[model samples]
Target: MSMIKTIKSLPMAVAAAAVLAALPMPEGTPIFGEQTAFAQRAESNKKQSTRKVQALTADFHKKLQKAQEAIDAKNYAEGMEILDDALARKANDYERAVAWQLKAQVFYEQDDVRGTISAYEKILQFADSIPEALEIGIIYNLGQLYYSEEDFDKALEYIQRWQNRVDPTLISVSNLQFIANLHYVRNEFEECLKYIYQAIEIGNSLETVEVKESWYSIALSSHWELGQYEKVRDVLEILLINWPKPRYWTQLAGIYQELGDEQTSYSLTEAAYKQGFLDDNETQLVNVAQIQLARSAPIKCAWILEKAFKENRVEKSPKNEKILGQCYMMAYEYEKALEPLSKAAAGDEDGDLWFQIGQVQMQLGHYKDALDSFASVIKAFEKDKSEKAKEKTLSATMQRGQAFTELKRFKEAREAFKTAKRMATDRRDKRMVTQWESYLKAEEAREEMLNG
Candidate 1:
């Protein structure tokens, strides 16, 4: 089975917005809410320490204010120019960090991801001088930026750096899921499972939370990749309860089959079919039919294939027709078997199909059709000198003699028995031919007596 590839990571804008929301706003800028945890901690430390906090110079502050106004007005180009000019001047570490922060905002406004990442990395260069809250936010935002750029390795690196600095209890479910997604994309299944299970456990523990479907999806794909079918089945059961998508139902049924629970597999697949989930999937429909036939429900199998054929969902290829024909024959629906059997027989080159068709014709007492079917079987093997082919030819000839006898064509019956005797190598086969010849003579004499 192909791995499910859906991911539910936050979009770049949303991730960036989250980072921007958590950090301290520039001077004279509007604060959206309370200060960040790191910001509050830094403020408390500042109060306890005698050392002075670094401040931006008046000239640098003026340029920063001008850039912020241009940005607030949606004048991205002017905002970028002013931030670039401020960064060009020789400034203190704190001033450079603030300028880069404003530049990152400008790049973000212009939807320039590379520029945004560059600006954020520039701020990180001043990590020792910048506020702890600002530095941590930049690191986390860089991870999200790299992810948006599809640089998964760099994304994971930066995200791990951010995680190390933050308290373990402060990490949210979304952060765990994001880390899990990074691991999944990198093919680190074991690590992916570790983080995903953590996220699932945390989310499930919350009274008001509904776990995201994509979390279970990641677990399902991770287990499948690791060849842990039992775990995959467990995740799929949860998905079926919460999501109940058609794909989840079919995939769960497949997982049951992989785990060697054929009975459960059949039951689940049949249930999905009853719900009309398998109607559009021809291969799966045919698989369910095969399982039904194996479980001795040939009538059910035939009904499925017959319906599929009528709806044009399944191709009426010789192989499919042969399966349908066999299903009907097993169910004792000889008359219904003839159409598909004849079509399948007509397309076969090996004569085995014709032999089966001949048997069905004999069951229906259609001696002429049976005679023709047996003749085709014999003709199909006439050129093959293999022992298996010769055996089939001999069997067809014997059946043909019976067909002729039933039609009152005693002369043809005698010729067919003569042909069979020539081909019979086994003592048992020779004995059977002898018995048939004796019956032919007795039948011929009985007919003569009746005519006289």
Candidate 2:
């Protein structure tokens, strides 16, 4: 997340200070004759001390200049050695800052992030002696440094210091975003929201400011974690307008669904689906279709499923095909339901899809076709010994008996009902099968009476 890098030359201190300092200390001889030699000695010592300070000051500059050159030449170790000596000899705060600034540059050039941070922070110790611009840079670097170390509180502290010192007009979008990120990384969401919004607001105003997608997403995530759905809605609208990806559209629809606004959610997803943004993603396609089903728009739901099925976009798995068939059935389009149901039943070994196909055909008064589908269900389960499969086989046998009765084939119907009764294991299924057999017997007796 860090982007800050490289270095700027330390603001030069006036080199002429060496010349002025090199001048002899003000001459002072004692007025007392008794202490004249002692006075001379004191004066000599004072002058010597002054010269020593001047030499230190000059030597510090010379070393600082060489260190800066080494840094410029990309010789960080050499630059650091000279800077260490410069730091040792600095005669005042200004000289110390010069050495510290060079040290920071050397560390930064060596790609030692932590060491660079130390050097920059050390420069701030003499803030009174540094230019305002350089001081602001140091403060900003402290924020960047602590942010790199994941010490968010100190990062924010330094960033806030920089913000307080500088004019509001001087604060850039990148700076605000960095401050916002520090708050975000620390889980201080509310504080994060404040700076990020301003960053976005500022970024929106300037063509040069590239407001990245992360800025908006961070806002969205914070709002979501806070359970501030309305804010989430607002940010999503802006995101949809700015960078309209399918995930964003899907999430926006989901937000509406969370609010119990199913119709709106379905409409939004339908719109994206129609615009082709959701096509490549099967889950998104199914989501859009499911939303319609949830909204009671079964006809529209069926149309979407059928169209995707036709385009081979939605998988033709039995599960998917059954859903398509169910959508048509829910819309009262039984004939339309049969096509996908037939395909679903074709390769299905468990017989569940075949049962559904049988029911739809029976509803459409296709008794023979219904009987055939029901037979497929029983045949599929005959080899399976699972109790669940036995129950399904029994149910299919009963359904087939009904289809035979529908076709007026009384003998076949009666035999089918008896088989179903024999196969029934559950008492409820056995009772139901017995009831159907009694009805078949009564119908056979009536037919015999009519023939006689």
Candidate 3:
């Protein structure tokens, strides 16, 4: 929070006055008298003010020289104390202002934010003109303080005020970076986009590569937050065309994902990963695979999933394994589906995953395996800890019994239906179980009679 040390106040006032006068004033406005009145008054009241200030400034300069001598002599604290006293005794407003500004610098060296802010405010009140640099410096500190205190409106007020005063043409790369961060912290996404774009514009005029690349990321992210997906796409296209970084590809993939274009998302992400854009994080890769599943490109989805799974580079959590299983099943690769599906089913006490696994196995003519999976589900809910689980478990068991019957294991199917009929407490469940059991028994009797 160091104060603006070299204000160049005289030049700033002259520039501001020139800009103001150049504007079309009223038809009869006299510029010279109107502007000079305030300047004249300040001069009159302090006729010897300049001389007094100069003398005081020389004294402070001498003290500062001695303080530097002490510092060079390895007496740090004593040097600081002497400098503090010199600041306290300044003779007039202008001289006093510089003293406070200098004190702020000293305090900043010691990391004393409280002293720094206090001294900065005194300088702001007494300085001749608020230089653009000084305005930016002080307002930036005020914005930070207000933000820390949770006073967002005040924070926004000062930051925007400072931004308005800064010359766009003179905004260096570092200044633009600072401005970008301030807008981001305020969550003014639109404003962030505007200034960041301005930075890009300036960088392009100067042919500055670093700032231009930075603006691409800033523009992409801000547009993403605003749900302006098309703008993000456009910015990414330009970035790819010009700079062609890995981030451009990854961001393009993310934008396509938002646009519900999963194939493009997958292609872009794959390109990024191949080109080494996406890091070991693999977040973009995961998103692309997931979106492919959503788009029903199951073979491609499974291919991506299997690559990540086999590499052990990314942890294959059970949920992701389940997705891979579903993809494989959709791709008609049932044998590959079985391993991940089985792991997902057995890894948790989830009735739905178990049901899905059983249904897939049944479709593949693995009736015995299907029956076992569903049987485990039924046993898991036998005590009926959750009513919802109980109903699901019963339904799955009934379906498994039907699957067994299709395999001509009629005796086991009959026993399963009988057990379920006895266990069912809800009237609807009881009725369903009774009907199924009766049908099974009738079928068995027909088989026996035919044999006889």
- Which residues of candidate 1, in runs, are more than 4 Å off? 1-53, 69-75, 348-350
What's the best-to-worst order under TM-score? 1, 2, 3
Q: Tell me the lDDT of candidate 2.
A: 0.72
Q: What's the count of clashing pairs in each model shown?
A: 0, 0, 0
Q: Looking at candidate 1, what is the lDDT of residue 226?
A: 98
List, residue by residue over 1-452, the lDDT tens digit for candidate 3. Answer: 23222121111211111211211223443331132222332334332223212223455556755765665465758877886787677355544554454455555555454565566666667534422244345655555544444456776787677557544444455456546655766677888887787777776677544555656777777887888999989989998998987777877877787898877877788677767565465566666667677777888888877887787655677777787888888888888998887887777766678777788778888888888879777766777778788777778878777876877789778877876776588899888887887777787788889999
Candidates' RMSD to native: 4.5, 11.9, 10.2
- If scored against the real structure, what TM-score would every candidate get? 0.85, 0.70, 0.65
The top-ranked prediction according to TM-score is 1
C-alpha positional error of residue 40 in candidate 3 after TM-score superposition, expressed in Å: 27
lDDT per residue as tens, model 1, 263-323: 8888889889999998999998898888888899999999999999999989898888988
Model 3, CA-based lDDT: 0.64
